[model samples]
Target: MSARLPENPAPLTQALDACRHRDPEGFHRLRQAVAPAMLATALHFVQDVRQSEDVVHDTLLLAWLNAGRFAADDLPPGSWLFTILGSRLHSQLEALAGRPPSAPRAVPTGLQGQALWTLAHGLEPRPPSASLGDRLTESLLARLAAPQLPRTPTGELVHPPLYDARLRRKMLTSRLAYQAKEGFKRRLGRPLEEWAFRRWLAQRSVGQWLEAQGLPRRSVEAALGDRLDLEVNPGRLVRCMSYPDAFPDRTERRKASNLFLWSGDWDLPHHSLADSSRTRFIQDLWTHRLEPSRSETFRRLEQQREQGRPLRSHHKGMLLDSRERILEYLRLYLLYMENMACFGFDKHEGKDRLGVTIDRHGRIIKTNKGLHRLAMAQVLGLSEITVRVRSVHRQWWQRHAGDAKGRDALERVAQALPECVPA
Candidate 1:
């Protein structure tokens, strides 16, 4: 028997009818309504958020394009949608299993029964064979290189990179004391819509913003191309190529990025090898105490607490987020003995370095974890920090067309794409 939908199917039915009538607005509305649930389902099976997004994106597009073929006798609307999602899911699984060995895979491999973190150097670009052309990136870089580029945060062109040499020469001849300052309005602490709006106005470029504030200029394109000769010295701060959606406040994002402090204000050691050995016993406890192995560990622990017996300190709270869950099986760097942290590709909608969809005008998406640590590294002027990067593309509705009400929602979801795309 076909599984029934949890709610009334009228909304989906209406969206389908609208799509049959060739209404773009209707199709978009439908996508917004169902994409999240569909994506959640996809994630359960695929385990990779990016792959799951692909399945949802392809499924929605296919469903929209072919909705006209459905007849009165067709299966329930929910079942039909599931059928498409399932077909896409199958294809994704097959693609993973049959993938060529030469191709880079982010599969978490077990090492000595522990999950090992994958290390990705920033300067390495994807091989040409796997290239997805990105014209949006080209456009953004060209804009940044323009002679009229903004030098100050408030759009003041006091001393641009092009004129830095001139300023240096003048300083030698005369006393030149110039303080570049921009009373940047704090855009954070506002509502989500307002935060996203100002971010949109900022063009979502953390690197450019850093340059405007007189920091060292780093070409985003160069970093993405892996052409920059950046030395990987521990604790060095690298400018961000992607804006983080995890943080919606522009002021907060800017503070986090400029200071390289994405994680938190605390100076706790994170995901380092020095602490890995100490945590090994804890790791073993977690591993062997898997639901089956320590089937009654939680129960016994609770009972001991009830009896007034002290529980082991290892009895930490439950883990959360996609990164933490994946770390249970794969050996990766854990943040503060809880979260898994790595430098995956910038999966932010406008910030994806891969440029799978070319419409994003080259904006930096936000980072999920380690924002504070990254910002702090930059603030401390370190030479290098190793980051593991995963390539990412925008999710579905990449090419939506509509008024502000419709398009803004699409873009907002796009920014939140990283939350759904775990590496």
Candidate 2:
């Protein structure tokens, strides 16, 4: 395949032109436009991290100086850049390797931008991969999982007004309808939706409804089309959300939970939601300073168990509610304290990993998704833990990778993954 990706980036000539005249923003734009592709080609072709980086840096530095002589139409800037890059590579080992890597002196943030590109410049989706669950389980068994993806914080993330009458009203209506449908489906024993609608009203919606009668709603769709993103976190990711968001009661509930995805503006003061009893109690129990029996979550489960309530709900089905799955949970908490914590976070990506959502700026927000392990991480102070990026805001995809196509988007995500996690 050619060094350039099949598609050309937005005109690099203009940005280069701006550079010729010494314009700062133009320089930034030009680098953003071509740096990833240039670096990808160089790195993949050379298979040397240090050498590839130097080649890209030297090529860009040379390009900056020759911005005036550069013209766009004669040859794509990507092609020209790669040409220079290849030339640079010939000398990198002998001439450039020992020389200090070229530091971007134009802007202080130059280093930051390069760091982001290195992190986001990923090959997450070339050879097609297994589900996030499978990969995580494999890693866990091998005992080689360390996950931390540090998120780039937006200007200021402020929570929007929590009470919106119209939205809440609509949400209420949707919930009521869902419960009614579920009630009917449960009563009918879910023979693919139900026959009442089919016989009485043979519509497409009814037919579709019939197809989805008893199964729990589909929850795992990070949508690499059919593939899931690799759980590569080079930075620390504090588990973001709670159980309710992680395990919504209804399908609509999950969709409506998009409230956190909204831009609350970085300037406004943001306060994390008060830690739920689940988080607080677990931290308390983690110390063994307090008896696990004193935990309200544990006590509630004990009482519920005595009353014949299931200790772990949904014992054998999709989207199990283990809302009451507390007894064994206590034992597992001890396992970690006693140095037997083998099940790294990713192993639970199928359900309980710290689930989070990214906003337009790729800021991971708490959605109450994975509290149990999140609490453990807090107590353990583990530097790295795998996360289930359950969903990303539409704007996040658009902003990170325009067009947001599957391959590009996932790569962009992988590139960004390093920034979100700790080094």
Candidate 3:
């Protein structure tokens, strides 16, 4: 109770610093001090006391989880806390308004497009093989295609690998002997035999095998994490391999299929791997029509508009595929090109790729990820690009508040703190 209460950011940051070290008493004291202000801010937005309390509670929990990430030294405690409080409250508003929470918008820099295509199409491990039945059936067909197999009525190999019991028996016997020699065992401590091992392997997935082998799951996840990174529909099927070096490190045989040609211009100024929505504000500003060398058609349109005449919508904008474009009034001038990487993909933290979230009315709510890339695509006259969608049906707000420790302590803090009036 005698702890120096934070009247401003310095004392507040000190209290947060103490909380980072697992000082429960220090955290509680600070929570008690800040709760009133947070609640007052929440009440200003959502007048209901119950909803205000919920907002304050969630804010405190976020402060707890991400306290280390907050830059207490540079910002005053009130400013920092209020920012988080405002963000959380805004997300709540979005949810109530039937919109998904806002994700960070980024402009697609040249670096982002180049990096994704290069990395995505870069050397990577192949996906694991098909299921036991499919693998065996395919292998059998290949074997039957060999010269030794009997011919069908039409002179083709009989049922191509026609379910040879002798071959099957030989393979099983060989596998059993190898397992016996290697001293592999079942979970029950019994020696692993061919039949049991085969059954177990068939039942277990590749992820499970990695866990058993003590391999980091990140090995495959890192390469195949974007399995659906380029697709539009959320339910679209993903093929983990198909491109060269698709799954470089692994020997698996899976490949991606049905990569839709969302854009015809492969070498455009920008290409998006995810989906994005376009707002009228962005469209009217012609953010995408921006280029170092202004095009004549756009210049004419600008002039026509300045003269109080309506400009036609059919004016040719930036060239879609060519890096070369002529500026208006200058016959030989080329526009300067700016190619920068905007986002990068990573396994642990969700990759920062170009994406767009759409609202129910088919409007672009926001660019979920790559703002830079979207601008480039727009400038290039590209209409459609692949991107991830954050639907209103899916809520990404912090729903639950506690970690390993129960919510009892946090609940007590909320209860003991006094409610402060809004400024």
Q: What is the lDDT of every predicted structure here?
A: 0.36, 0.43, 0.35
TM-score of candidate 3 versus the correct structure, residues matched by position: 0.30
Instruction: Rank candidates, lDDT, best first.
Output: 2, 1, 3
How does each model score on TM-score?
Answer: 0.24, 0.35, 0.30
- Model 2, 181-298: lDDT tens digits are 7687567644432342333123334433322231121222322323323343312443344434344456545434432222223212233433556566655665442245666656
Error of 2 at 310 (Å): 9.2
Q: Which stretches of candidate 1 lie over 4 Å from their true place?
A: 1-6, 99-423
Q: What is the C-alpha local distance difference test score of candidate 1?
A: 0.36
Models ranked on TM-score: 2, 3, 1
TM-score of 1: 0.24
The numbered model that scores best in TM-score is 2
Worst 10 residues of 3 by lDDT: 332-341
C-alpha RMSD of each candidate structure in angstroms: 23.5, 22.4, 29.3
Q: Which regions of candidate 2 are displaced past 4 Å?
A: 1-252, 256-274, 289-291, 294-329, 336-353, 403-410, 421-423
Off by over 4 Å in 3: 1-6, 99-423
Better of 2 and 3 by lDDT: 2
Superposed Cα deviation of residue 337, candidate 3 (Å): 36
Tens-digit lDDT track for model 1 on 38-151?
A: 655666666776556655655665566557754536665655665556545543554466432111222233210011101111112122111111221222233235435323
